[model samples]
Target: EDLIAIINQYGGAIPETYGVPVEEIQKGIKSGVRKVNIDTDNRLAITAAIREAAVKDPKNFDPRHFLKPSIKYMKQVCLDRYQQFGTAGQASTIKQIPLDEFAAKYASGELTAVAKKAVTA
Candidate 1:
């Protein structure tokens, strides 16, 4: 709603749209969805920020004036998604593999992909 409001306030047009509900996404996570791609959400947030900045300051030609808010908005989206997806604070769990060991494994073909079980779809 905020996105649509801002876009309309800036005289831009987008058809009214809806996305998967947050509750549904949370359910997906509970059902073993490890990752959810959300670039569209990020883009919408960024575009809203840019449109708002441009509309609020029409005479301001400085790009930084527009970009700073977009960066802030984007960061908020990323942080929100991380928290929602339960990925926040989980980066610390990744064990750091040494570069030499990683390279040796790659050279020995130990990094080869394991075939997946075929899906009916």
Candidate 2:
């Protein structure tokens, strides 16, 4: 999954050698990616926003006013990405998986035990 995220972040246009591979990150979004990390984008957006703000108002002393638009823009970008990634309707699917059940299975190292056992047996 970490590799997938790294690939999604920097893997520029799919190579012809791969013969038209499906974008796994996009597929993951469709299945479910509850916590999508946007550190780089967030940092870049905020930095750009701050630089612009500072340039426009060199002596801007009010932190709240200076950063308000930046925060709003960052949030809007995050929302747009979430929608584009097909995660907008994830809540419904997420609700189907009970948290307790998921946690228990996860803790027991049996999240996919049944399938594994069936295959190995």
Candidate 3:
């Protein structure tokens, strides 16, 4: 949660409108919300960057020069996603949490799970 708070405070990936504010998201991050799913934003970023590059250099012949900025833009998008998920510079933190342990716990029904769960009940 503390990490989430930090990311949110830094204006990272999390959207601003919700019942639970940025503080809550931060708390959730602190409470072991490790994986944040993001796809659409990435797609948009890549598409927009490519379109911009194309518009800027419509008849350019050199693939390397033309694609370089697009690649950089995509990298920035990924970095932004990392910031939003509180996973930037998280290599050491990940090493601390053993994947095997998480898998065992999940298998033993000791871990709760939800992926955008919805209910009509």
What are the per-residue Cα lDDT tens digits for candidate 2 across 1-121? 1222323344323222222222665665555433556666665556556655666678887887558866966786678667766666677675576889989979988865332222221
- TM-score of predicted model 1? 0.77
| Cα lDDT listed for each candidate | 0.83, 0.57, 0.58
**Model 1 misplaced regions, further than 4 Å:** 98-121
Better of 1 and 3 by TM-score: 1
Best by lDDT: 1
Runs in model 3 lying further than 4 Å from the true structure: 1-28, 61-66, 96-121
Error of 2 at 121 (Å): 25
Q: lDDT order of candidates, best first? A: 1, 3, 2
Over 42-62, each residue of candidate 1 has an lDDT whose tens digit, in order, gives 888878988999988999999
How do all models score by TM-score?
0.77, 0.50, 0.47
RMSD of each: 3.7, 9.9, 10.8
| Tens-digit lDDT string for candidate 3 (1-121) | 2323333444445443334444565666776665554455444444555555565677876767546765676677678767765678977764565889979989998887656533322
Error of 2 at 11 (Å): 28
